[model samples]
Target: MSVYNQPRKRVIQLIILGMVSLIVVRLFFLQVVETKYSKLADANAVLKKVIYPSRGIIYDRKGRSILRNEALYDLMVTPASVKKIDTAYLCEILKIDMEEFRKRIANAIKREGRVRQSVFASLLPPETYGKLQESMYLFQPGFELLLRPVRSYPYGAGANFLGYIGEINPDQLKKEAYSAYQQGDYLGLTGLENTYESTLMGQRGIQYLVKDNLNRPQGPLENGEFDTVAIAGKNLRLALDIELQILGEQMMKGKVGSIVAIDPATGGILAMVSGPTFDPNLLSGSYKALNLGRLLVDTTSPMLNRAIQASYAPGSTFKPVTGLIALDEGVITPSFGYPCHGGYVQCGRFIACTHKNPGHAANLRVAMANSCNSYFMHLYRLSVDNNKWGGTTKGQVKWTEYLGNMGFGHRLGIDIPNEKPGIIPDTARMNRRYTGRWNSCSEVYVGMGQGLLDLTPLQLANAMCIIANRGSYYVPHFVESIDNDKSDLLKKYKEKRDVATHISADAFSQVILGMEDVVTSGTARGAQIEGVAVCGKTGTAENYARVNGVMTKQPNHSLFVGFAPKDNPKIAIAVIVENAGFGATYAVPIASILMEKYLTDTISVKRRPILQRMMETVTMSAPMRAKSKVDSLNSVSYTATAGEELLKKILSN
Candidate 1:
């Protein structure tokens, strides 16, 4: 009994001692050896602050910065730290009433809880910021002024394309794409800003500071050892020519339209102007929400980026495509001709031709030059009814496939957001529209750029690039490169695309020759520039809009598509003026002036009068003109009054 029981007791004591030693070591490590627990315990006394990086700068072609960052102040508040401060004094300095102050405080508390800081007043005006900065001490630990970088547009053009940044909404915060963003963070909402958001929004930094019981920052915690430094966002270099953009905007004043110019060599956008555009600064700084609200409610829809968004029938500007397609399909040759005394009357529907001359529809070049409806209508019919394709259904399928390769009826993958893929009627679509009883004659008007054919101004400009490049193109893009960037963000844009590889170069040359004649002796005579050969086509697209619950035909939309230096084209452009008369009147002159300015960098003295007249022209309806605030909003550089005064002075001279 004594020997066996004593050994068991000793074993139990040894086990108890080992367990106690392990517990002592674990406690010592948690208390003194490890820093994780220490940092966790220090969290109550330390203030965690986020250091925001500077957003990227946007530069136009020729190294000009289109936008800049301006210093602005945001009044932030922590509900828990707020005490019996002079609310009336603070409201008076902020130019807000006591009720507003209380409401803001309640909202802040509701959003971020009692201790965390939330914005009380955002993007303060200079005067308000100055007043609040001087009296900041009175607010003590409750309120503080934070420096914020606000975007300011110097040129005040390209508002629709440049876009604006807005605070992240609750819905966006939950999305995986925006997971990195917080509720109070600002992000690109539309246009180019949205397209390059990740590149433009740099890495965020974290800073920990020692704070007192009252929540005022005493000093940096651990001398900023644990803080992360913010890296500023990369700068963006755009292909946009600011000067060209400004000129286009000035010419398009008091008009509802868009202009898109692309560099055919690189597919880089030189200038894109959406008329009735507002100052980009209006969507930034103190009055961002107010100005945005006004723009949203405006009848003219200045916020719409018509260059890539609005769809319209191509009109005669589409005639070249019909000829090219017909030539590629072997349905017609350059010498192919159709007889047109007055119009097309084969399908029991009369489609009028602009000219009834004896040889107006003689050969492809002549037909294109005259924009003869009969010739193209016949070409469309022949291509769609070709015996090689078996039937009309198969023929249309092949035709649409060719059109898709030509970058029609689909998005061109531009850099900006919200690019609408224009409509191109395919076999299935035609079948649905006509209940499967359709034939080539049912949609023959498409050959002349009408009837089930719709395209954006961007697509039109890009198609010209295809012709200008002789059957090849690059996807149109705004940002040419990003500073200090190594990402493949621009790889697709740099790659050359051969959209019309099947089409012969000679076919393109024949179409281009007709376009050249269009400026020289045909429809777009007003588009001629001395010493430079401009190949262009005029379009007066038929338009219909519902007014008073009834479909009514509005004024035709004036349009022109062209490229300069015909042989080695550099710039390709498309312009559309809604509800304006003939393309030769409004669109042709504008395109001519823009081309001359871009190629030579200065408008010739002889063309100054044309420029002045174009600047003074107001194509907007009288009622719309009265209701529009865009003219006043874009007063930063190009104002209507200034333009009128300049015109008067020019005329007097």
Candidate 2:
């Protein structure tokens, strides 16, 4: 074998060397040119996660915050791959009992198993999250904290108008065909929140990542090459003035009804208050146990938003529209005559008038000032008075069309959600009601805003704006402008002007003059603003058979509608109190205070501090305003000479 001088041995050694060289070349090629799969494998080592951006904050017109963000975390877990977390550790870290922890994890397991996506925790505030993160090592790979934003209302009340957001369900997802909502996403449930939900709920953000076979996140993953930054929802600016809203609440006190205020010139809502309001903070953002419990079990039904939902007969308030309708159609004029000798005499029954004039006649101005029921009854029939429109049926139909023009019988298309399209009767409605045998007899009641007619406090307020504007108005809106996020709503509404209540400027003058008389010396005298020149109407409607599953002697709903600075109006408002006796008694006084708070910047003229202190003590219930409270207020008296100083301070400030 040492005799390697043989050719075959030399050849075998050469072949071995050649094979080794070939193998090395192949390795080099694979590493350099054919590295498609190996590069991916290397890149997949790190995981990239995205953090959500903060949502935009909502503010009032003056830049005061109405909505804000509080830190909260959602527990996200992958069920199929989750480590089957130990119940004891989770309970200890999450500050939950074992039973509750087990139940919660089980729910997540089931939901994720069915949906194939991660299941979100119910809700965890910042404090709870801090404790969990401290001991996060015990939770393992499956559990993660997804930083989230919850909508919050800071004022703590005004539930209905502000509304609430809830987790999006299957039904909502289908309806929101253009939405990117997941099952755990939130949606507005009512009021402005619902109407402007799209603007409020900003777009969701997504990040791409690579997971190993063990589902562990590798660092950096592509340096966020596959992620898009999340955009925040736009913040809104509102027309509502907070101080004015608070005064309305004080005035409404213990009553069960609503008050609506809007700018007559711009048709912007100043306030829409429903009594028994729940603190809005409880519904979203941050909530406390005591406040939530009180609201949840409240006997007064504080959760119901009566401002736009509850509808009632116009009562005497309807008198204005009736009078205007008659004048516009030329059935009555400034000089038109109608006899209301203390009442109108009709088929064996007397429609008694509250105003007694010795003569058998009164003009349109007198009829309006007096709010004579008989005058409206006769005037409303004037549309059908001649039956000149082909037939009596056609004539009644025309009258209905005219009423509908004044923004009755339908919704005003406001920005808030869940608003009702209030009921107003026309020919078909009457046919169904009276079985096709209806005429002026069935229709006369509508003239007085009775019969099947209905209007919400909001509707009444909007109608009053029409009176103030004289011909048309911007549709009433809670928001002055949508945040940049909702420019479309603001844009669309800007182009849309509702001019249904068209009338001659002269006709409005007569109506305006009559309304002035109401607040200056007539029924709504209590609503007078000392120097602001408020014009208004008072309505006392009687309609009571049963209430709350029982019968009672409730007299009527008290109502008042008005605008200020009679020469050139500013604010318009409507207030209603259920079973509240007289409009002047409660409703007018409240409107007067609200107007003063905003326009004059003072609540009362007599001893500003003392009056404020006394009024603050005078609560909705007698028990709250005790004898001790009155005695304490009475003791804080000023001399007659000093009263003038206080009055000047109140007026000037």
Candidate 3:
């Protein structure tokens, strides 16, 4: 070898050594410093499982649990882990055909890829669960039984407001609010459940399990060192009296209307009943989907919470508000009198009054007691035409302001979903309705609680609360408190709203006296309770329905609004019976019975016959009665014969 050739060889050797060194460093970084590959390898050997926490229970006022949880099982499957197995035997136990099994398998694969788990059969019946548990080894790595909690109603009442839960949908999954939820998670679907979902749905936990050769879980990975513990949901305490709620439902059965009762001091709901309601249990567990479909298609609308959702004309029950507004505007004193000969004929329209006596409209208290249409109409005209406001539009705006303050024309912010803010005619609404050329006489029927005035039974009951409180009220809510909760979920409900503070106490006193007279000697004489000093007003709202694209008059809806023990009032209520003859007949008696039951805790012996008749009364039309099977669906055997027999037994005792 030559010396010059040796130098070139040494230089080439150095270059090759540098390249080898660089390769070694890169390999060390990839294998030791980076964690992405290690995680991927662990994923293959580890099974990730989500642990759902127990949902909260709901309790009524007296610590009785209205809603409870029951343990159910869901059949889950991993398509990738599936091997040849006895598919037919499984189908037999599940009560499904081969076609359905195949379809479910295909759907499971499509929903979540082959490696991930999906719900194959959910909320399994107890018999199927037992059979599956015994033969679970045959399915091996693919099928698993998971524990699930389902809601159950113990009292089988309050279907309209208690609500139900359902599986989260695709739309909800994409939203930021539901970012933590997966495709198969369940959530509150309606009513109170929907409103307090965030507080009721607790934190989810995660666990890792070691996988065997066939991808089956053997045990907890690393002794559960990386597992997270789930937190249970907080319980809700409501102000509902279950017994009163049951009685309200009984009185409303076989009828078409709503009843709402409130505690005047706290604005806590005692009972709310929407007639033709189905059992709440129908919306839980296995039959939820089928029963929900039936309820959706039923013509009677059993699912609607009509106490807050349905709007009706206030009728004469609203006359007290008109009188209060008139007194506040300085348009008339309580002693201001008007003479009416059966009706008001001055506006070129004869608005009839129920009483034809001369002194019926002589004063505010007397007029309210009589529910005199002419007196209220004249007061509305005088208030709107007063020279101080300069014009009818300005006067109408002021009147609407007063109404808004008194919990009208807007939602009262109840602690539930789907509360309807009933319609109230304002200046803008009047302009649109009358094309900008309207006068006080144009909407004078509002004074008598007719025309464009519409309110919910909830609103009527709340108005009674305001009057009973002498112009102050709390926002009506079902939940009084939450168990072990620190959230600001109930901040608004605790605050008092003095809406009618501007109105004089003297004005309220006159209205209260008039309502007292209503129960004693006026339209709602049937609402009187012995030794209770009940103050109430009755209303007969005119009903019109569109049939075959033509307007037809139906029977008037009977309504009653009242508060018991006039001073230091404890209970305030509103009852409406649709398509009934007069307020005195059905609405008055229903309200009176409920008030007596709540205040005295039992019906007197003398009123036992009236309770019996109310329990047996059927106000539903023949076609409606035949078409609806809600009573049967509820599993409550309510027959006229049964009611009579029960009443006879009570009376005999």
TM-score of each: 0.92, 0.81, 0.93
Cα lDDT tens digits, model 3, 385-503, are 88899988888888888788888889999888889999888988898999998998889899898888889999999999999998999999999999998878898888988997778
Give the C-alpha lDDT of model 1: 0.87
Residue 508 CA displacement from its true place in model 1, Å: 1.0
Candidate 1 has its poorest 10 consecutive residues by lDDT at 637-646
Better of 1 and 3 by TM-score: 3
Ranking by TM-score: 3, 1, 2
Residue pairs with backbone atoms closer than 3 Å in model 2 (clashes): 45-218, 46-218, 46-219, 47-218, 156-279, 156-280, 157-279, 157-280
Give candidate 3's error at residue 522 in angstroms.
Answer: 0.9
RMSD of each: 3.8, 9.6, 3.6
Question: CA lDDT, every prediction?
Answer: 0.87, 0.69, 0.87
Model 2 over residues 191-255: C-alpha lDDT tens digits?
Answer: 77777777877766667666677766654347767677787777778888755665565445456
Candidate 3: lDDT over CA atoms?
Answer: 0.87
TM-score (C-alpha, index-matched) for candidate 1: 0.92
lDDT score, residue 188, model 2?
69
